[model samples]
Target chain A: MKFSELKKAVAIIGIALFVVVLSGCSGGDQDQEPGEGDQAVEEGLESAAGGETCASCHTDKKKLVADLDADPPQEVEKSEESEGEG
Target chain B: MEAEDKVLVAKEFLNTVHGQQGCTSCHGGVEPAASRKEAHQGMVAEPSAQKDSKCATCHADAAGTFEMTLHKTSRGIVDLDTGVLAARINPEKADLLQKAVDNHCASCHIDQCGDCHVSRPQWSGGGLIQGHVFQETPNPILNCTACHGSRVQKEMLGQGPSDFEPKLKPSVHWVPAGMQCVECHTKEWIHGPSTEAAVRYEVKEAPRCEDCHVDDTFYDNAYHKQHAEADPGKTLLQCQVCHSQPYNNCYGCHVGKDDKGLAYFKTDKSEFDFKIGRNPLKSQDRPYDYVVVRHVPVARDTFAFYGEDLLSNFDASPTWKYATPHNIVKVAPQAESCGSCHGNEAIFLLEENVAEDEREANREVIVPKPPPKF
Candidate 1:
């Protein structure tokens, strides 16, 4: 084959390989986005499905519901806003 | 009340409608992040601050009612105006007093729901009551009295300084019964709409001694029988007259701004004493001829840092005003003897009891010398 033709064929192969590699990386990331959350406490606890994992320890449904109905736990997590100022 | 205590969160709470919400839904800055630092970035220490965004969605009714609570508005101090300090101070000076309170005292007022329900009050250095569990009832020591330390908590717990000669007595109702503040001061009281009343006395449903000590024959005793017999012309007595013991009395409170313009408060002294005085507030609701009076440490110069002539009408109201000290005993020293209260010059707020300069402001609270014989 001619020298120019061989060079063009090699360039086309490199471009095709780059496109395939980019698609694979993007696809893998997109697949994992909704699968897991950052915190272990909220793992598998989806807003739509509700916090089913919480029931693992709090097995008493009646007592739990009563506690919530009468005095719902008002959870307060750490905040960046109040980071420096007490 | 300790800082190191790790409050456990109840797993059951997550099973309810509230649990259905994503942790980050109410508590932001956690979602779409990989690291702990990123999760807590821009997060709120108290999620209740976002009640409108977090709570109102699922629990609209309670969120609405909670907004109107006295805890939410923190208006109790506003009623301090009824006392001599606010009444006597010039309107402009009174404005400074408001400013002083807004900076120092007002922060203690309720800001969000989690302050009471979710976690220990932020004022006491916030900590968890349970291990991240949702609590139905608040920890009395941590949540309730941490902020009420000066009066209710200290008196009811019989806590005193190390130098105090005799240790103060705890409330009778507290020790054996183990009654929590929420028992008497119910959710209705906490969650009720703000009446904009300045003091607890103005709140119609202010917890009363009579609520538990019902006037039924089943519970009637010699003391009740004797006191319950109403006299047609005389002012009815309050239950605290005989039941309450001497409690902390603070005097000559002065608030000033330091050279750098930081606000600070100073008090002359604090003593434990009981004095019966004519009720400054003689409305139909409080028809007692004599009521317990405690000295508060508010002076004309309380807000001297803010401005001068702050409390020009200092004498317009009594220095020692009617009060309800939380230190209650079923049988106080005076309750056993008729003369302890009746014809007892020492117990009554006579002219001799108060400071010479304070007589003018305390005239209304001063009982007449000729005590009624029992």
Candidate 2:
């Protein structure tokens, strides 16, 4: 075989390998994506209850102590708002 | 305190050994970031969604078996009941009825493990029971009664004054003894696969009187054995037929969709009565001549909102289906004497006692004549 022909053959094989690798990667990406139902349910919860993870804030003993002793109190704002509304 | 903080304060806080695994272990979807918005991203409100993945890792047997339980597949009841109705109707009309049922009846389906064990049911607007503690056995009040409130709860707890004629007593097993649902209903019965059961009666390992009573024991004395066992084939009766107290019965249940697309149901009447009718089902699991049948209050026009004359062959299935009433007493009126059931035609649902429309469906169940010199 000619030296030039062998060079062309090697280039062709390299391109073929690259295409196979690319296709395999894309297939994995599709497989890893969450299905429609699961995505919807999880997304629904994420949006619910004002985007709060109750444990994230409530479980922290320091944060809980700070929250309980909050001055002017959370109820005061609500009462004032109610008065304004009335 | 914030409203959220108040909820925390009000709850009875306790941590299980499992809690050491971190909140994100069970409740995933929180981002690792400290910001509340970022932390809550893609959060799963109920960890039950991941039961097969997370919980089943440790509780494979329970989670796998629970997947087949009646509670998990309660929607099957609605399907079976409606399928019977659909088979009689035209394809177009059946499809319409099914749509109404899917919207209304299927809404009350039971949830996954976390719904009962970790939190209150979604139907009751999900919340923590004793502040996010994992419970081994469900509290009857918080779990069972939450769903079974109207009928079983009323009967078991003797709640509704209207359901009784002269203020009936609560179940003896429940009243002084304080027996909860789980006491009699075992884990196998509750969580085990129930593929055999088309209705509750057909459940293979359903709690039977003989299960605890033990054949030939005191509770299963000569009298019980005579009726339930010795009969061979001539005369056999379910324990509930004779042992159960008068239970609540509802008539004329009507289901309809409101303008806002919510399912609403109403019953014309509810009354307490103890009546013996012939067994509607006669399977090897439940081979009985007589059984306690309760009128479920489903009329032909139960789903008239969806389509008119949907259940034309309403009499195909008996309005009165066999039931295991929650109300059971050590001594019942029927047990007083053989005549209480045999001689008394009133107690047995005779042809004359049944409504004209129901007579055809209850022909086999309705006693032809009073017991002859029993």
Candidate 3:
């Protein structure tokens, strides 16, 4: 597979592992403090690529497209010709 | 940047040194935000614009004194217009010229650390080149040339063939040697020390030709043995006089407004030519009797659009200024034979070469006569 595809595959596997670990945590650690738990470390890792993080929208190429449904950045102005020299 | 909105970050970005901080660390936003807009509410596009930015928090030494550097302050350019030129003419209207400099000439130099390391300069279609990875060394093309493409880029890469000599090839350092700007212009030189040096030439740490080219490199050559010697009061030949190719020269600049009603500078003529003339910036450090000269894009009416008599005393300054062209080669046309340069008025900025209107301003730079046959 291409490098990008491989990365995507790894991301899918990581997501699967997070789901499995969260399921196991649901059964116990009810009294554990958030930061001290293995799940908290897992959550930290998840935050990097998680739905709530910058990576979520930024890494998703589909999030930005020229398609009709594509989302765009707000507050863009017509670019002016640059001025300045040495 | 038609797709300037598309910030498709890479998955591996989180593993980089800066990534570990999380997005909200440098770019402050409403974390666990009310909305996406709220999450980016306080996000700065180029954080390094501020002195004590996030980059400074970690890399304190460099960021601390960055503002004083010639690359940052561009104090020389501003100083010329508002200081020296003000004393020359229109001391009262320095305010308007200062305003013009701030809006136009100052834009390129206002660049910050991010403009070099993380993305292209803001003026040069800024965006992440490597998915927001922080480069230890700035990419020469993306960062350096983005602002300096006018001459340095063309000369260094030989992207521009010389008009004076159409057969001229790229710089030997670039075409065959494959040297990058960083090889000579080290990181320290680029970052600059904490000193408000008036000119880039004052930056002591900047590179010198002799620093790398040792004694033996020149001693073997007959031309080098005779003319390379420099002393306190004595003037020696500058390296570029023989080593560099004919480079670009700009003339007759007028600052005016376009259809959009925005202020801009337009050079009337940009030509490629080679000229040797007496050095005006001659000092102990640069005691060169004859050096390469290039016509700067300054005319009597340069600032006429702003107000009458703004640059009334423009003739006080030389239009043909000292230059160090970058298109260096092992053997140049001037180096072929002694006769090629001696008595060669074509290669010297003669009185006839000066434009009728600019002769007064360029009087010091115009060579009255050619050197006698060698």
Candidate 4:
């Protein structure tokens, strides 16, 4: 084969390799995002750590003590202004 | 002349003897004795000592029978040191016997015994000649025939011990075989310690059929159904009758219009029906034991009349009230109302379902491809 043809063949092979590597890398990245999306979906379905998280701040003992110390309101005070107005 | 003179002298001497001592008063024997004096001595001796034979002569029959009776034997044993004849006296019999002997011994010896002895008239109060008078206070004088005859005492008293022996009668009611009296009659007998037994044996306070039965599981089901049914005669409506299907998933409302061309509004009164599920504790698998739900409609407002619409409007915005754990009161929008069925967990996820997916999409979609701004 001629030397110039040999150069053209090597360039063609290099271009093919770059395209294959790019596609493979892109596919893996695309697959990872969907998995992350699935994880987020599952997490969203689960109840917010609302009650569970509050427990971390207010342990059983702390909650009991707070309950003991807290005075019950004598009557529900009428709102001077509606809180929900804002 | 000599004969006449002797006869006169003898007459004179006899007259003088009669005058001196009243004829044979001082003399002991008169005639039939070895001599005249011996006969007078027998006549003068104090009447020979009266023996017990005198009393026995009259009391022959009674003495004979009394000697044979257990009372006589007991008397002998009690007074063994006393003479044999003395042993005949039974203290228990003595009072009665002495009275009889004193009053009627002579009568008994004679044929007159039967007059008083045979079915004697019932005596009243105490009296002398009421021979062998039995004071029948509370107890009567019992004869041998009183207890001995085959049916004698039974007529006075009752049937024999065999009558008391328990015999099972054929049951009029259908009782399960081998069911003991104690099963239902728990306190019938004294079965335990004395105090416990006393408490148990009080028949008046003992449990009746209704005591364990009124609210028992077997009968209570029917009892409750009797009151609950709309038409009791038509249906033997039990809890299980209407609740044949176990769990129900409730839906808020219908989005589409019905044939009548009126929009349907879901109300707070809407409920899903449920039946008693299998007991969870009995299940082998824990996960499957969770309460299952199958959607069913309990109530629906089908008629779309103007009156119904007004009622719905009133229900939607009546004076607001606080919600209780047991009763929720609200007419939130349809989406918000889903919480009534799905609960808070699913309600929270509605927003997250769209939001979280959209955040990850990484490109915004504008309605159409926009030209780049100069």
Candidate 5:
């Protein structure tokens, strides 16, 4: 290969490597932003859930409706009788 | 008869005698009247324009002073239109001076002449004797002992020093100055409403020991300081210390063990040892032995710990996620968690008092382990 062409190819490769490293560093910065999912998980661990996890899901009307109507009476009755007057 | 009617009689008698003769003519009999009746008759027969003679018929000793007092010297007493006595005798005429004496003096004395005069030797005699007239005896001569008798007077006056005696004098300490019975006593009805009188005058409210000794707002800082300075180590000095009865001075509570484990609770110390069962659901079946616990030297950081079994059942774990060098139990709760038992402030103080070394020793004592199967 010609020496000039080899030097140009090597320069392109180095530029590409630098871009990858820069992106990797910025990726952690992106997670630090508020409203992100990872930040929410950190807050959840600090508060120890304390029933708030269940409350968050149960408070959603759609989810609550889905949970209530998902099972028919036959299935529910069977579970209740098996528990036996608990 | 109404006092007004009697005063009218007195006025008429005065007018009659004044129209005919001088004051000395009728009052001359005062010298010979050894009895009250004689003196009263002499006064009634010849009324005096000289107000002193009018009073002197009975209150002879008081007459000289009364003549000199503001009541007699001032025109306010005799001037029918403007005099206080005249108004009292005839209130419709706007004479306040007359009304004051008539309503105040005549109501009690009854006989107007007797209100002023004295005839009996025991009553008439004083230091103020002059020819045919008695002047006012000095206060020293007219002391309570004279009329009430020395023994009764001394008892009533209290075993106090005489007014003339110096307070700092060695002999005077035995007698306190002005400790007279009259200090608290008055001629007014003192025992309470007398059954004899249909309308009873309410007795005056007497001063309590606190009245003069304490200032207004005595509960405030200034007065309290004064009181403390005056009385060292005396109970009354630190009134608030006893009165406040501070409740924040102590800490105590209880803990209960259930099938799951143990939980702490704040409880009344008086009923500390009463067994409360492990499960709130089965409180009726009291199981574990009741232990009464109390924290000494109440501080801000006291705490109680729940057993592992109890924690597992309740799912209530302590706040500290990571174990410290002093805490052997993996999930040992912070002292603040026991606030239900030790109280918030007390728990804080207790935690503060626990030195690092002590905490380390305590941590060594507790070992985290799996529950042993029974």
Candidate 6:
């Protein structure tokens, strides 16, 4: 092939590679539509106290501690055989 | 959950095998999720909840056998074959009992891998225990004692829930030796190689008093010579019979939904008791003719709140079951003198002492009479 033709082929290959890289970076899962899980996530967010996101409050130590401490887990086995025993 | 701790967890996790794979691998949230809602979509809160979860993909040895393990199955509460539930309830009402279990006892059962290794048990107020890091051996106090505190913690460490009045004292080994659960309960036993165990004591690999006190000279003690070493036809006593302190005994646990529809369990109040009874689990492994027993929280109407006559065959098993209390000492109160226990009729579970409703049920375990003071 002629020098000019070789140069044109290389340019085409470079452009194709660039387009593929660009599409790969930004186009992942974008074509899929939101489903019920996404809807539930939205609903769950609406119900979250103060509309906090996973990161917004979880990352803040004081907020996380306060939220957890407010309704913390059971620390020890409640061994009372009945409803009201010490 | 400080911001720094969160960063540290992520940072440390990234360096580990699970962390190397990244969060989206097992957790199932969107990788490049732009918003909290997007990230939350398809996210699984406990990916290891299933018997064959991604955790099983790597820890196959443990995860596979875990299904049969005491900690995972809580067999005492729910197993069909060779379980306290099975021994009590009739076959026809098994399903109903299961529903009762789900509503009331399920919290006590291990539902996921993280329940033991990464987080505090859900029954003991569920949350991250050690920041979601997979620990080979969980912190005994935070994870094991959190659920077992009523008995094991109190007996072994001599402390229990704040409500445990008349606070107990530490066992001979737990405080002075500083021995952790794994020190005796080996990893093989904890993770499990699988066995047909109806109760924790049935696990063959479980720690034994003889395992540590193997010194032959130790048996020179008259009590040990007479009891620990087998003498045919004689009433061989378990070590706990002489060593264990009065441990918590709960009776008549009734479980059902409350008027407000929340699940609740009630009992006849617990007591610190130490009673020697005929061995309910008399097998080659446990040859003792007499052993320590504790009054479990079960009655004919224990599950009546769930359904009428749910446990129709409750009389099949004794309410006073075999126990290995942790409160052991070199010289226990009962061992102060032979007379302290030999003629101590109160320490022996007798017919007159049993509740009228439980007399027939406890016939096998109820001592006809205490041994004559020799």
Q: DockQ values for all predictions?
A: 0.01, 0.02, 0.12, 0.00, 0.00, 0.06
Docking class of 3: incorrect
C-alpha lDDT of candidate 5 relative to the true structure: 0.28
Displacement of the residue B198 alpha carbon in candidate 3, Å: 1.3
- Tens digits of per-residue lDDT for model 2, B202-235: 5677777777775446535656766867355557
lDDT of 4 at B358: 28
TM-score of 1: 0.74
Per-residue lDDT of B321 in model 4: 11
lDDT (Cα, 0-100) at B177 in candidate 1: 72
When only the first chain is scored, the TM-scores of the models are 0.41, 0.45, 0.32, 0.41, 0.37, 0.40
Lowest lDDT sum, 10 consecutive residues, model 6 chain B, at: B2-11
Write model 5 residue lDDT over B1-374, tens digit each, in one string: 21111122211222232312333365443323333334335354324334555445544554443333322233332334433222112233234323333322232211222222221122223221111132222122243334433223332233223442211121111134434333433222222223232211111332222434457655575434543344545322222211111111122322333344322233332111111111111122211111111222211111122212211211121111111010012111221132322222321222333334233322322212311222
Least well predicted 10-residue stretch by lDDT in candidate 4 chain B: B320-329
Candidate 6 segments exceeding 4 Å error = A1-86, B1-14, B160-167, B193-195
Worst 10 residues of 5 chain B by lDDT: B318-327
Best of the candidates, lDDT = 6
* Stronger candidate by lDDT (2 vs 6): 6
- Tens-place lDDT per residue, model 2, A1-86, is 99999999999999999999999998877885343334433342243445444454554545655655663233321111111000
Task: At residue A34, give the lDDT of candidate 5.
Answer: 57
- Measured with DockQ on alpha carbons, how good is candidate 5? 0.00
Cα lDDT listed for each candidate? 0.67, 0.67, 0.72, 0.27, 0.28, 0.73
Cα lDDT tens digits, model 1, B1-374, are 42223333455445344554645566666554443356557766578776475766765766778776667766655534552245676775566767767765666677777777777777666765554555667778878887877777777887656566445678887887778888878777777664655566776666877677775672367666666445775456677888787777887766655555555566777777778888898887777777888887776676676778767777887878788877788778777787766776778888999888788989888886736776
Sort order, lDDT high to low: 6, 3, 2, 1, 5, 4
For model 6, residues B62-157, the per-residue Cα lDDT tens digits are: 888877778777776667666667777877887888888777765677777887777776666656654556787878888788887878887888
The sequence of per-residue lDDT tens digits that candidate 4 reaches over residues B292-336 is 222222112312222122112212211111100100112222122
Q: What share of the true interface contacts does candidate 6 keep?
A: 0.11
